[model samples]
Target: MHDSIFIKSLFNTLYFVFIGTPFVIAFQLATALILNIEVKGINIFRTLYYLPYLVPMVASVIIWIIIFGHTGVVNQILGLVGLGPFDWIQNVHLIKPVIIAMGMWAAGSGILIFLAGLKGVPTHLYEVAKIDGAGPIKRFIHVTLPMITPTILFSVVMQSIAYFQMFTESYILNKGGPDYASTTYLVNTYNTAFRDFDFGLAMAQSWILFIIILIITLIVMRSSKSWVYYEAGNGR
Candidate 1:
């Protein structure tokens, strides 16, 4: 039973990160780009965009719980579309997507980081790209993206580590329920140690999670050299 739970939790954790990180990064980058635009009241817009990140994680989770529960706002919206209520946190296939959706609540921090990276990109580089006959898309690909690669790398590594140990939201929202569909590594460790009273097993699980995060982080760092560029002429 322990082995089965452990293996299942590990696979679920991996699946969550792999499926969620891209969406998180994309949304963060898109927000950053939109906010980077020079406009009146931009700071207020940025603050509003970041308001969700300012909320405590537990509070955010609670809000999401209410939103995803039966007869909640989400269901009401679906009802408008002639789709009946759907159980979000309980359904096996839908649970991970719900968790992934929850991650978007805190994506404001990533937007801030991406915006900082966008700001650091020198204006002259954009001018040079334009002079070289680069269109908007070409300029973004050749200049904007390469310049922001470090920020992207940082975001990926941080998000991967966080998602690998995802606990609070899953614990509070799903309790790793619906047949353990949401049992991430950290949740499994918690249950093993506290609920099952298997300190040794839980300790082993913790170490395994650590090693997994370390290996994945190292892989990201190593692979970054091929894509991440530094104006200082160093690759990652």
Candidate 2:
């Protein structure tokens, strides 16, 4: 905690998690809801949504680089708007958001999980809710949401854990450059071990990370009782 670098990286990591995870979760769930509806050739739409996740990280980063790099596609558009270009990768203010956007690209798996959860929601519950005069939003709140709480819990915990260890997106993009603007705790820990060869500090960082993850996961699990509902009445 006394180490300035450690504190900064931890803050950046927390920033990434707190700022990015909820939007990603909501996006995944919303997309899943749309895709779950009975419609023509929905399988094709699912495949398209999942394709970005399947793309190799190197390829994905390269595409983003071309789009966000100085004088790249974004610059081209900005030029049209009478704004020449900003150094996206080198800008301290922008790189984190770019990395967060990269994180958003990997929401395909979460979407699939939510889709499965939606599918598992018993149709009879919706019928009962409709018979009770529940409108669409009320039916969703009263029937679909409660039934899917377990899935939401799973997604939330998993997303939080994943974001806590976020590295590659930052690492590949200039190795968390622009004066460490994008460096996360995991990235810093990695450099401490492999790049700087400070095994002692690296080990300490690892333990700290473990504690953080454990505490957050336990907190979420404990809090699940208020929101999550399981079929067997577990953690109700």
Candidate 3:
């Protein structure tokens, strides 16, 4: 029974981490890139983007439940466009997209970090690239990307850690419903510990999560030397 439980939990955790981490990283990086652009009203846009992150997690989950609930505001908007109401939370096919959308609501923190990295990029590099007749695309590829690789790597590590332990959204919103379509590893651990009073199993599951995260972090650090850059004066 112990081995079976451990294996089940491990598979669930791995599945959630594999699927969700990339989405979070991609969305945050894209948002960061867009916000890094020099444009008017950027401050306002930044604040608006980050507001969701400031909200209490429980409250944010509640708000999303209302928005994604069947016959909720989202469906109402769709109805206005002559589309039928869709069961976002209940539909197995849409569960991943719904979770991705919910995750995106709090992408501001990642964007902020990326913006800091963007600002830290040496202006001299961009100037040199411009002198070499590099277009915006080329400049971004050669200068912006290489310079910000460290930031991107850091964000991936952080986001992967967080996503591996995802529970609150699944708990509050779907309760791992729709035939366990949204059952994440953390949720399983939570259920085992709290609902089932399986403390031993829960602890085992938690340790598994810790080991997985540690391995992933080590992998990121190992891969960092390939792409992550540091200034010449700064000792890496």
Candidate 4:
């Protein structure tokens, strides 16, 4: 609790969780919604969306580094718009954000899960909703959203924990650099235990992280009772 560095790293970790996770979820849901419909080449589009997740994480992070690098593809495109040649790697303020952005690129796993959930939704439910005068938005809100609450809960919990333990991408990108602005909890834990040889403190720090993640997961799980739907029970 008293380790300021741990506190800072925890904040950075949660920043990634709170900020990055929702967007990733939104992307997954939106992409899944679009891909859920019957359309020619939908399978191809689904495969394309999932390909990024299948790429090795280390390799993908390296690719992202090159793309977001100072004079990399993004900056060149930005140059066309006269916007950015910004130091994405070295800028302290941008370090975590860029790392978070990297997570969004491989959201294929989430998209797949959401797609399954969407496809599993009963077609009869939509028919019933429509019979009650529910339009598209209302059908989605009253039926689709409720039907997918279980999927949403699953994604939220899993993504939160994944983002909380983030280390590799940040470490590889710039070694959590530029004043450790992107030094996530796990990354700092590694440095503290291995680099600083503060095994005791690092072990304690890790336990704290475990407890925090557990609590957060429990909270989400607890809240799901009111929202998550199960067709088998037809009740919460």
In model 3, what are the clashing residue pairs, if there are any? none
TM-score of each: 0.97, 0.92, 0.89, 0.95
Please give the distance, in angstroms, between residue 69's alpha carbon in candidate 1 and its true position after superposition: 1.0
Residue 12 accuracy (lDDT) in model 2: 91
Candidate 4 — worst ten consecutive residues by lDDT sum?
A: 1-10
lDDT of 2 by residue, 1-236 (tens): 32776778898999987888888888898899999988999999998889998988888888899999887998999999899688989999989888778767867889999999999998989888888999989987888888999999999999999989888888888787777888889999998999889999899999999999999999999999888988876566
For model 1, the superposed segments whose C-alpha errors exceed 4 Å read none
Q: For all candidates, what are the clash counts?
A: 0, 0, 0, 0
State the lDDT of candidate 3 residue by residue for 160-231, as single tens digits.
Answer: 787788888777888876767677778888888998898997898789878878998998898787677776
lDDT of 3 at 235: 20
Q: Model 2 segments beyond 4 Å from truth?
A: 78-84
Residues 65-173 of candidate 4: C-alpha lDDT, one tens digit per residue: 8998998998999899889899989998888777777777799999999999998899999999889999999999998998899899999999999998888898889
Q: Is candidate 1 or candidate 4 better by lDDT?
A: 1
Q: Clashing residue pairs, candidate 1?
A: none
The CA lDDT of each predicted structure is: 0.91, 0.88, 0.81, 0.89
The ten-residue window of minimal lDDT in model 2 covers: 1-10
Error of 4 at 121 (Å): 0.6
The predictions' CA RMSDs to the true structure, in order, are 1.2, 2.0, 2.5, 1.7
| lDDT of model 1 at position 121 | 96
Superpose all Cα atoms of candidate 3 onto the true structure and report the RMSD in Å to 1 decimal: 2.5
Native-to-model Cα distance after best TM-score fit, residue 168 in candidate 2, in Å: 0.6
Query: After best superposition, candidate 4 residue 165: deviation in angstroms?
Result: 1.1
